[model samples]
Target: MKGEFMSLILTTILHFAATNIDDIFLLLTWFLQRDSKLKSSHIIFGQYLGFIALVILSVIGALGALIIPQEWIG
Candidate 1:
């Protein structure tokens, strides 16, 4: 049971890291920029909103795939 729990935790972390790797670089760029007007809170909030949008779109796409006819796809 303990090993299974640890594997689940590790899988979750890896999946999250893979999904957000691009976001990590984008955030780094935002932080490194000088003379930028954006505040930290604003950047964080924007990132959150973008993530929410992606998740919503992903769900929609998954549902759409299920609804789509396989013959139509081919």
Candidate 2:
């Protein structure tokens, strides 16, 4: 039980870190740009929307994979 819990925790951490790795650079660039008119709130809102879209697309792809046959895939 403890092993499974630890694995789950590690997987969650790694998944989140991997997905947001690009966001770190993007947010930094947005903040560093001189002519940019975007506020921090706008950046945060855009990030949220983007993440939600990613999650939705992932779910749809996963479901499609499950529904399709292995023979048809290749």
Candidate 3:
């Protein structure tokens, strides 16, 4: 039951982040605008680059978890 509860929480977190995709893009656009480079292409590029970076970080995190000791949780 505890495992199931954790799964539900993880799913909810994923859904919340998926819903915020546009907000992320907009935030990137704002930052670009600060430098007068918020053109459509630049904003799109920023969004793609941010997404790739996030994917890399997630992969690293998952790999790190496999190597890290789980004694704390146990």
Give the candidate number with the greatest TM-score: 2
TM-score of 3: 0.56
**Which window of ten consecutive residues has the lowest lDDT sum in model 2?**
31-40
User: Candidate 3 on 2-40: residue-level lDDT in tens?
Assistant: 999999999999998998888878776577666554567
Clashing pairs in 3: none
Prediction RMSDs, each to the true structure:
3.8, 2.7, 5.2
Task: Sort by TM-score, best first.
Answer: 2, 1, 3
Instruction: Report lDDT per candidate.
Output: 0.88, 0.88, 0.81
Clashes of each: 0, 0, 0
User: Candidate 1, 44: how far from true, in Å?
Assistant: 0.4
TM-score of every prediction relative to native: 0.65, 0.70, 0.56
Model 1 TM: 0.65
Give me the displacement of residue 27 in model 2, in angstroms. Answer: 0.7
TM-score of 2: 0.70
